[model samples]
Target: MQSNTVDVFTIGFTQSNAERFFNRLEKAGVRTVIDVRLHNTSQLAAFAKADDLAFFLQKINNIRYVHQPLLAPTDAMLKAYKKEKGDWGVYEGRFLDLMGERKIEQRLKPEMFEGACLLCSEALPHHCHRRLVCEYLNDKWNGALSVRHL
Candidate 1:
């Protein structure tokens, strides 16, 4: 696992299963969890908000948590992407631009761990914007990034 070969990774927390998600994250040894969901509140009462999740993670596992709305895709950007990519081509560039301009890459470069993971509320990576974020980070910053479901 070369540091230059791998960038950030992503994971989802849908399907109403917290035990499985947290277990996988713990097993992965993820030290920092970045939540990219525009709205962190979930319909599922348990995972309702990012603050609560952060508190739990910090108190129980000592993992750092951050909610980065700048990394979240905006509605305008999504519409433009849909038009440009014809709905299926995930808008990787827009997100990359957002993260890059906001210094997210610079900020994350030093914080990235072997098990760092970006989180959202989509069950599957393909069904979520996280796919685009992961793709951009993998293609532009590092090549070995992986997106997984938990």
Candidate 2:
């Protein structure tokens, strides 16, 4: 099936409090939350911890929460970026390769983006894997979906 346009949103909660974070998603009318973090259960997540976030999404707005760990960068890859001060270009290339190897483009259901949002921990899309994921998807999916970074 071909979609005229798929609205895939992206967001991160680093600089946001729980209320504002969830509020943004709610206001956007997000029906699904695709957690693209390697460690969704980290204590640093506050209210966005795996179980709690899933609970809250359903309880607050009937939004579905999905943990797509495969979408996350590997620990080694992330270490190279943060701990080793790796070049953004290198990181981007590596991450893109990983996504292709995972065949995520083929596996992803276009219907899922009807009212779905991609999630990560960064405050903004710059230098974030979430942004790369959206860009890759937008291109590979033949522009069926346009990403809106929230």
Clashes per model (N, Cα, C within 3 A): 0, 0
Worst 10 residues of 1 by lDDT: 82-91
Query: Which tens-of-lDDT digit does each residue in 91-145 have in candidate 2?
Result: 9999999999998889986677888999998899999999988888778877777
Q: Candidate 2: give its CA RMSD in angstroms.
A: 2.1
Report the C-alpha displacement of residue 82, candidate 2, in angstroms. 1.8
TM-scores for all predictions:
0.71, 0.93
lDDT of each: 0.68, 0.89
Runs of candidate 2 exceeding 4 Å displacement: 1-3
Model 1: per-residue lDDT, tens digit, 1-150? 564454456777767566777777787777878888777875654753787899877876788898878668876776676456535444555666776787655565533534567888767787567776666556665565644544
> Once model 2 is optimally superposed onto the true structure by TM-score, how far is the C-alpha of residue 30 displaced, in angstroms?
0.2
TM-score of decoy 2? 0.93
Which structure among the candidates has the greatest TM-score?
Answer: 2
